[model samples]
Target: MKAVAIQSFGSPSGLAVIDLPVPAPADGQVLIATEAIGVGGVDVLIRSGALADYGFAEGHIPGSEVAGTVTAVGDGVDTSWIGRRVWAFTGVGGGYVEQAVAPVDEVLPLPAGLSAVDAVTLGSSGVVAHFALAHAHFAPGESVLVRGAAGSIGVTTVQLAARGGAGAVAVTTSSAERGDRLRKLGATHVLDRSGEGDADAPPGYDVIVDIVAGADLPSFFARLNPNGRMVAVGMVGGPPPADFGMTMMAAFRKSMSFATFSADTVPVSDRRAVRAGQFAAAGRGELEMVVHELLPLDQAVSAHRKMDAGEVFGRIVLTP
Candidate 1:
């Protein structure tokens, strides 16, 4: 198997393609012949050793989403899954390779109207957007602010918020080109880079689907309307540096709520259901799967570089 591995914790230049022997599936696992891989900021973070809290070791293969066909299955897995087109998590982070073994429970059948690439592109992202919006209890006519709205999960979050009848959909991104593209995708207002305070919302937002939790987070919290909810999904900006406690106290007077969420918190069955729904939505063209770039597996280094530079407008998929 050919996999992209980080030889050291530093820049995208450290990502190297190396050959490894494919492993057999353990009990309850299945072997997939990878077709497409989803590249994102988390992969760059793990490659740079910024997310050491996750215990990613040196030479770790960083990948979370893979869309492919099930070539084989292990004991306790049904034989019927063999030869099925699917997308799944590699359990840990081995989806960067041409072949990966993932737990059967984590994989799902590819829907009829969706391609393998679209499946992996929207698979985890669509599921997370659904779960997060559900957690925030987003309602019609509510105002929404999507932090980091140019990325994969952020794109889906923005689409869902707008389609759900949000009276206003505000987004933050570094590129004007991407911001304009986001407007066509449903963003009512686009702020450059500084997603928090740049846009004016005199009444504040009813729900904030925040993917970037940086020093600007306090500004977002303070922008929430009475009884508004802010769900932090990703910390692409590292961590919050300001005194959030003071802001939280002030927001408390307005009955605002704040929380952090991860798709892993959802039960496996529920996760599967949400993912399937997202896949079907994409198939129906009700949701947009913005595939910005498709690169060969060996270009993993360049892919990470683009993500770190914040130049890519949408999801980047890798073909193995």
Candidate 2:
């Protein structure tokens, strides 16, 4: 098997491809012959050492989701899983390889017509977006603003909010071109990167799904309407300031609230159900799958560079 590993942790160039013996699935696990791998924001964080405190070290594989065919099943697993097309979660690492192993509970059969690329792109992101909307108690006909809505999770959020009957779906993107792309995905309004103060929404948004949490996060909280809820899911721009809670308190009079959400808190069965439903929706064309680009497995370094540079507008899939 060929795997990409982090030789060092500061730059994308640190990722190196090397030959390794194929790994066997452990009890309750299945081995997959990966056909597509999803390059996500977390992969960049792991490569840049931003997640070092979380135990990501040199030699880490740096990928979480992949889709392919199951070739082998370990004890306690159903033999029928073998020869089936499926999407698998390889924990925090071990997915940037030709072959990977995942727990049976972490694997899901692909919808009848879903391609490997689409499966990997929507596998985990769709679940996060769905759970985030549920967490914030988003209501139909409510207005939604997806801060930094260019990545996979952000893209999924925009589409889901629209399909769920949001009266207005606004997105903050880097340029008009990207905003135009998002508009096609059901975004009703496109605002500049500093979207919190956009003139289009003087009344404020009812819900905000923030994927970029940085020094500028406090500004977005000020744009929330009465009873508005904001969920922070990713901090790709960096962590918020220490006094960010003060900003939330300042808006307390309006009954606005802010929270950080992680899909890990959702029950495994619930997450799986949502994932399967999303996959079916995508297969039926009720949802869109945004894949920015596809690259060969050995180009893992280049893929991370593009993601770190903010050049990728959607999920990047790597073919093995």
Highest-scoring model, TM-score:
2
Residues 1-320 of candidate 2: C-alpha lDDT, one tens digit per residue: 99999999998999999999999999999999999999988888888998899887798887899999999999999999999999998988899999999999999999789999999899989999999999999999999999999999999999999999998999999998998999999998889888843567545899999999999999988879999999999999989999998988876789998889998899889989999999999999998899999999999989989998899988999999
Report the number of the highest-lDDT candidate: 2
**TM-score per candidate, in order?**
0.95, 0.98
lDDT of 2 at 109: 94
Off by over 4 Å in 2: 196-198
Q: Model 1, which residues run further than 4 Å from truth?
A: 196-202
lDDT of 1: 0.87
Could you give me the TM-score of model 2 versus the true structure?
Answer: 0.98
CA shift at 44, candidate 1, in angstroms? Answer: 1.6
